[model samples]
Target: MKKVDTNKYTKLTLSLERIRGIITELPHNGHRFVVLYDDKPDKQGYIQTILEDDTLGEQSPYLLETRVYHTEDTFSHYRKSCTKAQEIFPYFEDFYKDIPFSYENWEEVTKEFLED
Candidate 1:
């Protein structure tokens, strides 16, 4: 089954498997990606970001970091919902900024990366 996000601002509640599927589809190079989902009893949701760490050896060039975002205190966190990095563009707030899209927007964000 496929999970869809009707709203583009709300965090997505999905299983780890689904989240992994989305991660696999994201670009592994040149871009840092974020994945948002609830994998535990906590409904607050988790944000996973993959950064291309040049410091790491060629065999492992990515660094995965996980952060928690509380819905009530979203103003203090990066994105309000689950998000994945679409490109390697620069942002003053960086990945800590609110995500512009939702789970349904996965295709919208990764479209260009996948096509490449």
Candidate 2:
């Protein structure tokens, strides 16, 4: 039998206005953002930041980088200025099953999804 991993993953929460501020403050041509997850124990959290490597001419790997902090102390220590709380923990195996658009569309969808 395969060993089952029982760790948890949380959803990082931020206000719509705050998210907008993050977007607005990002440098031009910055990495695009998308929210994606995997089904493994110890999964911490998800972020909407996904990026495609444009320099590669063909079949470049898509980047699924997300910044996840599992503890308030760690989060606070690393992200001292970010006050958003991580309140929702959903198992990775059961979340984001029917994302309506491709990762390439995250910028638009994220703006829409976080709109007030």
Candidate 3:
């Protein structure tokens, strides 16, 4: 598996209020988000949250999917998938223990990861 660049990704610590703001703007209509961690053993920490949107599929009122992975090492982690925004908070608490909006702050990091 490809390992995350330690120099590029660092542990994120944000205020609870800021975290709440990030969650509030998440579109509940038909978009999803994935919480990712650094794929390093000693450095296992939250890297970024990815948004997954399926706008072209023809389904009857598709629900958003939020996939959370809590990693123990470089290769393994527990997975929790949910659709409701309410269900996502616990995972956020576990990862950040603190606290998104605009996603403007996240765009650069996310794009860099995706492009890699």
Give the Å error, residue 42, model 2: 17
lDDT of 1 by residue, 5-87 (tens): 31232345555454444444444333235445433454443344453543442333333333334454441233222233322
Write one digit per residue (lDDT tens) for candidate 2, span 1-116: 11111112134444344444433332333424434443445544443432244354223333332334446323211111111212111211223432222233222222322326
Ranking by lDDT: 1, 3, 2
lDDT of 2 at 104: 38
- TM-score between candidate 1 and the true structure: 0.31
Best-fitting candidate, scored by TM-score: 3
Cα lDDT tens digits for candidate 3, 1-116: 11211222334444545554445444432223333343446544442332334353222222222222244322322223344445455555554432322222121322222323
In terms of lDDT, the poorest run of 10 residues in model 3 is 98-107
* Model 1, global lDDT: 0.36
User: Which consecutive 10 residues in model 2 have the weakest lDDT in total?
Assistant: 76-85
Residue 2 in model 3: shift from native, Å?
A: 22
